[model samples]
Target: MTLPLPRQRRTLGRTGLQVSPIGLGCSGFWGHRRFAEGAAGRVLATALEQGVNLLDTGHNYSGFNAEPRLGRLLAPLLATCPREQLVISSKGGTLTGQAGLGGTEQRDFSPAAITASCEASLRNLRLEYLDIYQLHGIGEHQITDELLGTLQRLRERGLFRHLGINTHSRGTLDWLAANPTVFDVVLLDYNLLQQDRAAHVAQLHEAGMGVLAGTVLAQGHLLPYRPRLPALSDAWYLARAWLKPSSRRLMRSASKMRRAVASIASQAPAQTAFAYVLQHPGIAAGIVGTTRTESLLQILATDPCLLDAADRARLVAVFGDGRGSPSV
Candidate 1:
């Protein structure tokens, strides 16, 4: 049931950079049932042909395989497309290593580690500069002065065009406010299922920072409720299954509420979920990731004309002021 890739573009926050509304997530290339290397390259090619200009990867993804693979695939294409036209982004703040029978692991962040991470990413990406270099996860303990200093130095050295933090916590936003002008973008997990930080998102946007929404599908719990087989072992899937009966009941109730809302919204359940975020004034781009190229295309193809008042009301009713458990 894969849909055709849609053609859509939006301005990436204050950078004035325009890219496809739907960006490709490279993390999918890692972990279980990894996509074949050749198939991965083809996915990028297909995405490019379909007008997806923004590609995201991280140093820790796929035990450091994602960036190099993406570099190999996009290097040749760079000559064909203007460098400024593509929004290539990668993140730091985490270290990855091979752990046993094809397993992977990661380490936390530090100032020295940030520099080293960017250097390694630069080499793996085969690029002199990155359009966006993000700090992967900035929990309270990780956001230190040294870490901020390191990122500033990287920008001073022209290693990256823009710098930002990728986090879902309010603490990260607080850190950004403390260190003004240190970041140009912020990638956070925000969706209808989790809206606890919607006000924070608005605050960041008001502060002249770009907002990139990730995990818009609430880790695939929204719409159609297709459960992958047990062997998949995806964290979100497992978490949903393990939730207490009360939580599960709430989740099921929320899902049913969302379905009803979608029915009245005249959009597919998935599209409705995405549109919920798209309608947010603060969001500059939505980062949707899929290993399946067809799924990626489907995300891009859906036309999110503005969500109407009834749609907004329905969302509020189901998700309740867009906050708490149902807002992921």
Candidate 2:
């Protein structure tokens, strides 16, 4: 079946890269137990056909297999299409030492590591340069002057069209804003579950930085199959068996609450979550990851016009505002 085309493109931070308002996160296409070799190419082709011009992946995803997978898939497509028509993004500052369900681990962001990672990614991606190269989350100690200098040099050399950092910390966002020219984009974890970064987002936008949102699905906890923790009551368990996490651990009361929220929100989960992020003023795009081609297609098929205030309120009630209370 044919997927719906995106209606508009958004400017990617200050890089001036125009991308589909919703982009594909390529992590799901690699390292997962269910991801097949050919699936990545199929999904990517489908995404392009559906008018998704932005594809986000990282070196750490799938033990460095993600970029290569994307390269194999995108090579043929790139040969035919003008390179400027697509936006490709990848991250460094982490490494996948092994390949398995959870073999990936974070690496330090030394200047040497950053430089080495970029060169390796270029080779893996089979591209002369990346459209965007983001520094995955790193501690303050890791964000050294040397590393920043290296990023600046990479920019000067045209190794990447733009530089960015991905983080969930407000302090990091604040720091990056203070030194705006050091980075072009900032990928943050923003969703209905967390609004603490709302103010930071506004700040970044004011500084002319691109803001891309990840974890919009909260690492799949918001899906129908999330497992219940032991703390949850039997009533909650019964109500949300379908939403159980892939791995069932000792349930927690918070698990019950989470399941309750998921149950209520599942009626229109994708619509609610996607709309919640899209409503944010500074969000250039929402980076959604999914293993299922149909799920990606569903996101593409959604009518941007359907998200309304009532839907926003329902999402707020389910996930709550940054404050401890539900926005409802």
Q: Give lDDT: candidate 1, residue 92.
A: 85
lDDT of 2: 0.70
Q: Candidate 2, residue 17: CA error in Å? A: 1.0
Candidate 1 local distance difference test against the native: 0.70
**TM-score for all predictions?**
0.82, 0.81
Q: In candidate 1, which residue pairs get closer than 3 Å at backbone N, Cα or C atoms, i.e. clash? A: 6-300, 6-301, 192-327, 193-326, 193-327, 193-328, 194-327, 194-328
Error of 2 at 156 (Å): 1.9
Where's the lowest-lDDT run of ten residues in candidate 2?
245-254
Regions of model 2 farther than 4 Å from truth: 1-5, 29-34, 97-104, 226-267, 317-328
Question: 205-242, model 2: which lDDT tens digit per residue?
Answer: 88999999987755544555545453223333233333
